[model samples]
Target: MASALIMTGPLWFFTPIQVATTVIAGMNCGASTLQSPLTWPLLQDEAIPAQYSGKQTEWLLHGSEIIFPPFNGVCTVANLVMAAYCYYKRNDGLATSAIASAKLPYTALAFALHVATTVYTLTIMAPYNQKLKVASRKINASVEKGEEKSSATQQEGIREFRDAQAVWKARNYGRGAVMLAAAVANAVALKVSAGL
Candidate 1:
């Protein structure tokens, strides 16, 4: 003789909110980013030499310009939708404390992080991007004219541009870290939704 177990609910129990939350959170954590600025440095350092930096940087930067705005916008919208879903489920236990003295508003945290990234792009990256554009153009123009670095000023300008690019590269690590945190936050949100 064998015993059989009977289940009360359907085989699948995911509601619409839960499904949507899972989808968006899955995207945040598992998907690749739309931005490729980080990879440009590899090309700049290894494949492309300093002499070709102007043209390639200009090309890559323009490509980034075309892609990132809408991509980041979509990210913001996704975060908004996530926050809304989390909000609607607040009464379902999401609003409760996650740990001692700490409330786990995971979706809210994710949304704030994305907003901060946007603000950073606007305030910090924008000016630095402008500097890069100008430097690339100037270098290209000079190279095109076959002007060998004859003066201290020209050399200094090149050094400045190189330094600026280095700083931009370093800064992107911070950006990557922030976005990683956002993804982790969204992952937590997904976990919370499971219990609901």
Candidate 2:
């Protein structure tokens, strides 16, 4: 039993570092994206049509789509596993109660943040994303068929697209803040566990 516990110990030891690094990377990516001129170009040129503006915003956001899933996946899986293992070890007399208690709250906080980010994305951002996708498809199809650029329907689509992108960006910023907090908590967990 002692041998088994020692063998599996590194998972708890190293996973928090991975979680913290991934979260911080995600936060920086989001903050930089949000601050980019192309992200909110209205400050530069208010005259740009809503359609083009929306496309820029959508594409900028798409850049993050590739990175977020893997980051969140690793954080969620690793932290939850670590938390459970810590609890098990403590109960099994492999870890002392003080160390376990010290580590568990931070690990649990990181896990909760990961879950919160996912829930926020699904509940708050999904609808806007769906609207943005639909509007983008229609607008692209019309532009492809060489339709006149300023048709009333096209303008309406652009307006919808822009609105969705704006809301998504704002929600994404909130998600980024959550991720930042998770990173900090994970780092603190690592420090607490290091004494073990």
Candidate that would win on TM-score:
2
State the lDDT at 183 in candidate 1: 62
Quantify how close model 2 is to the true structure by its C-alpha RMSD in Å: 5.0
Which digits, one per residue and each the tens of the lDDT, describe model 1 over residues 29-102? 33323233645556457345444775666676677667655655565676676566545544554323222012
Alpha-carbon lDDT of model 1: 0.56
Q: Alpha-carbon error at 114 in model 1, in Å? A: 0.6
lDDT of 2 by residue, 1-196 (tens): 5334433664444544554655564665465446433445562244875556657656755765666766777787777977776676555544456666667887788888888877876787667767887787777777777777687667777777767666766776776677777777777777665555
lDDT of 2 at 94: 47
Off by over 4 Å in 2: 1-12, 15-38, 42-46, 49-55, 91-96
For model 1, where is the 10-residue window of minimal lDDT? 1-10
Q: When superposed on Cα atoms, how far off is each prediction in RMSD?
A: 6.8, 5.0
Q: Could you tell me every candidate's TM-score relative to the true structure?
A: 0.68, 0.75
